[model samples]
Target: MLDQIPLEHILLLSAALFTIGILAVITKRHAVVVLMGIELIFNAANLNLVAFSRHDPVLMQGQMFSLFVILVAAAEAAVALAIVLRVYQHFKTANLNQIVTKEG
Candidate 1:
């Protein structure tokens, strides 16, 4: 089924998703939303990796790298959420601007 779709289309979709993720990360002030954006970015990369892997005949290196990327993303999310929780506990808010502007 995937073979029916052209590689260019897949790449375009991935690029669009990545761009949206970038916008969300840059524009959102909430930590959770930013984290979600980061996940979106990861997913976009995963899509590209999988799409490219379909064309390869000898080795599935792209799929392997995608798996590694997923593993790293999961670990990163766990650590980032822990840090966000600590920041919220210390600052009493998840707003990035407010947290930064407040005096320690």
Candidate 2:
């Protein structure tokens, strides 16, 4: 099915997703939004990996790497959210700028 679509198209899509993720991470002040941006970046990388691996009949290195990426992203999100929750509980805000500004 993916063979019908050109690799260039897949690459373009991933590039766009990566750009959006970068922009979100740079512009968003909320900790959760930043985490979402990080996830988007991970997804973009996974998409590229899967696209490149689709043609492989053996080894499937890209697919395996993508799976690891997903696992790591999940672990990262969980830990990041836990930290965010703790920060929010202490500071009463999830906005990174506010938290930082108030810190001594």
- Of the candidates shown, which would achieve the greatest lDDT relative to the real structure? 2
Per-residue error (Å), model 1, residue 47: 1.0
Question: What lDDT would candidate 1 get against the real structure?
Answer: 0.94
**Candidate 2: tens digits of C-alpha lDDT, residues 72-97:** 99999999999999999999999998
Model 1's number of clashes is: 0
Task: Give the Cα error of residue 101 in candidate 2, in Å.
Answer: 7.4
Q: List the residue pairs that clash in candidate 2.
A: none
State TM-scores per candidate.
0.91, 0.93
lDDT of 1 by residue, 1-104 (tens): 87899999999999999998999999999999999999999999999998999989469899999999999999999999999999999999998988865478
Worst 10 residues of 2 by lDDT: 95-104
Which pairs clash in the backbone of model 1?
none
